[model samples]
Target: MSVEVRAVPGESLSFPGRITRVAPPRTHWAPVYRRRVVVADVVAVVGSTLFAYALRFGNAHAHPVQALLLLGLVPVAWLAALFVFRAYERRFMGLGNEEYDRVLQASVFTLALVGTTSWAFQLEIARGYVIIALPLGMFTILLLRYAMRKWLHGQRDRGLHMQSLLVVGHRQGVLAMVRQISRASYHGMRVVGVCLPPAADGRLGVEERALAALGVPVLGGLDEAADVSVSAGVDAVAVLPTPEVDGAFLRRLGWALEETHADLFVAPAVTEVVGPRVAIRPVCGLPLLHLERPELTGFRRLVKGTFDRVASGVGVLVLAPVLVGIALAIKADSRGPVFFRQERVGLEGRTFGMLKFRSMVVDAEARLRDLAASSEGNAVLFKMKDDPRVTRVGRVLRRLSLDELPQLFNVLLGHMSLVGPRPPLAREVAVYGDDARRKLLVKPGLTGLWQINGRSDLDWDESVRLDLRYVENWSFGFDFMILWKTLGAVVRSRGAY
Candidate 1:
């Protein structure tokens, strides 16, 4: 078979198309992850149900002993229901929102089953016990999942529980996938090697140099992907589109990968499209990707605005003492007003005054020109991890994000939401392209995907991409997820600077 392809550039390889073949190390961590989730669910389900049963009927002297015996079996049935939902399956655990969704589904199914049996049998004991236990069990299980996910994420950050990935594709496709996957470590797929498309041209050296920059080893051409994965002990092979790999080729490649015990995946060229907006449908025996138009105007916008105002109003009141203390600290530590105000580009490209507790000296702005050459920020924003202009108290304030507290008032005033795109400066807005201006569809936020993902540390493109994604895929549930994630992001102070 004749194959005309271009090598996807990643990392330089000392042994291109070669990997040491030995008995593969049993390094898979799926068992540990699976076991932990199952144990946590069991504890949550059993403890909540038992506690609910005791609370409801423990003091009732007329309660039959048989009722208690049957009540003890609920946890067993609930555990079985979770397995029935495949909630603890290694494939579904620690990836995306599926785990949590499955947990909720399992709990609901178990409750429904219990209720149905009770009603069908006409049992008198089916009253308040299940009602109390159902909600309690669900809440407890959700909490446990959250805690376990947090712990699992920490492990993944330290290079644990990762799937060894081999990418095969064209130069640009592979590079894009590498960057996207590299930024999202929580996805748990680590790029171990890459297989570029075969090319008989002199540009192979150039391709090698570009792929080498990504720091993953270059492993031969896509034609040898199965052999390469087997030799490298790869857990997954991500097949990206190249001129040579078509539907027929991919079908055979999937079958080939199974011989090496490697899971197969395909990465589409699409980027940052998420939520219900994107779907896959089969028509005429071909899969078609569908993208829905983003909706900006609706009752949801009103609800979001109202949530921002009410939450921020309560926040400002509750944080009054802390705000006042910060004000005093700013006065004592530097020569400036307690609050800093700047004109930021807001919804629909409107300009509004954004407020923050001052975390820099009064001359911070004047010194910007002198420090211009030393800036650590990207094209659209100015940032410095250890700028000399910061006051002593400013350092602590910034690290803990206390300096952002004054933005609550901005939220209360409707100039910003509690979660949306970053509030851009006038200069930043001046440089925005037509497409980037989509970020102005919603109000700027005190915290958003930008804040929770990697505030100042993210590269310019990633930051812009995340904000635009938020704008295009804005939903009430997404906002809630961001708000929930914001607490952990702040506590960890990750990429805050």
Candidate 2:
């Protein structure tokens, strides 16, 4: 069946194609999700208060009802601070790092207020209670929000909580966006229909089957975009790269969609330029996007370096026995050295000896040329799922990535960061593209975006794209997330040979 939306400006109207079987409309879901988060915050705050009270007083019931009442006041005051900071707002609930940032903001603001109040009232607040309760509440709140996000992602994957989108742009742009949005189901955008710009009509060469395969039907031209949007129950009108999606058109489009309570989302042709690097400021009614130069040096780098050193040290210490076991297995299964050291290209094209537990035959490198013609790997890197050179021990080591445990030393030695772009083979760097050379800006990582996304399985272009994306948008939080995701990726053993 069909629902209604608006048209883009100026192309002939045709009977609009429609999307079907969309689960009921979820336009008000953000608020519903926000409410869940609010409830979670309350649970977290209350539990933390009780825990703090117990931790401090040991269930002594020293003042009976008075102590319980005093402890209860903290949660009420904390919730008020969260409300004042707008941490419970719907806009910050589902995407990016903003939710965590808001939670932290609210928590710190509450803590500050608590401290100030205690000082003003000349009441001696127990430091243990303040420290324990604030951290526990914050941790519980973040855990609950993470659960909510996971639940939301699950819903979106099954076509719930998705924003219906009408794409208005060139034929290529519409198709590309449809496919892109389809691939990233967690993005929660469903491109239900498309409206092409008139100038590109002759170049249409549009394949109905290809677009329909993604459940996105093209509905005439840009003139009918608004009408198609309304007909499709579109929640957002995506104006892709096209001259027709200009200032006057967008201004009017915004007005029309506002009446429908639908949003106008514009996408420029450029990709991967996101996060803290981009900002939009209006000048003379034109919204100008400001791009910041990536900072590779200074305090953040020091923070990253310190984190790498400390984390790698702990990892090595904890994994010491596992490392020994792998080395022993390799020694028993094959006639080669337990450790493998290969020259790899690092930051600024410097060469470093990258270490690993040997996960291939001693003559694996010598045998590479013989297998070159039969290589099943992506371009540049050579990999084979059933490579004959891999010993039995090597297979198990590679499967669980136990072979790379020695690289913790690389991270500890200042040769690498715990998370950065993958260290390139010297030969890979030799033929690097101008754009790919940006991967050399930081220390190579023991693991990174490329590693977690798909180790040996990603195509050369995708691998390079991920590396470049990481180089451009390096942040400590991003690194931590990648590291967290790495565990799942390793367990699944996907893309690993």
| TM values, all candidates | 0.90, 0.85
Instruction: Estimate, for each residue in 1-497, the C-alpha lDDT of model 1 and write its tens digit.
Output: 22223334652244344446422354567787678778888788878777777787677642464365346667888888889998888777776678888888988998888778767876556467778887888888888888777787788888777778888988767877887788788788788778786556535665466656766666767777766667777778898867788888787877777777678988666566777998999879988998888878888789889988999999989999999988998898777688889899999988998998888888889999998888788876778888998889988988899999999998988999999999998898888888788899899999899899888888788788889989989988888889988998889898876
**After best superposition, candidate 2 residue 323: deviation in angstroms?**
0.8
Compared with the true structure, what per-residue lDDT tens digits does model 2 show for residues 1-497?
34332234553224342444332354777878888888899999999988887798784663544464447667888888788777877656787678888889889988888788778887667777788999999999999988889899889989788887778887766776686688568777787677765443443254444675665656657766665666556788888867766677777777677667577888865567778888888989988898888879999899889989999999989988888877778888889899999999998999999998888889999999999998777899998999999999888888988888899999999999989888999889989999999999999998898888778877788789889989888887889899988997889898778
- With candidate 2 superimposed using the best TM-score fit, by how many Å does residue 334's alpha carbon deviate from the native? 2.5
Q: How many backbone clashes does candidate 2 have?
A: 15
Instruction: Tell me the spans in candidate 2 whose CA falls farther than 4 Å from its real position.
Output: 1-24, 27-32, 58-69, 171-179, 198-215, 268-270, 281-287, 366-376
Top candidate by TM-score: 1
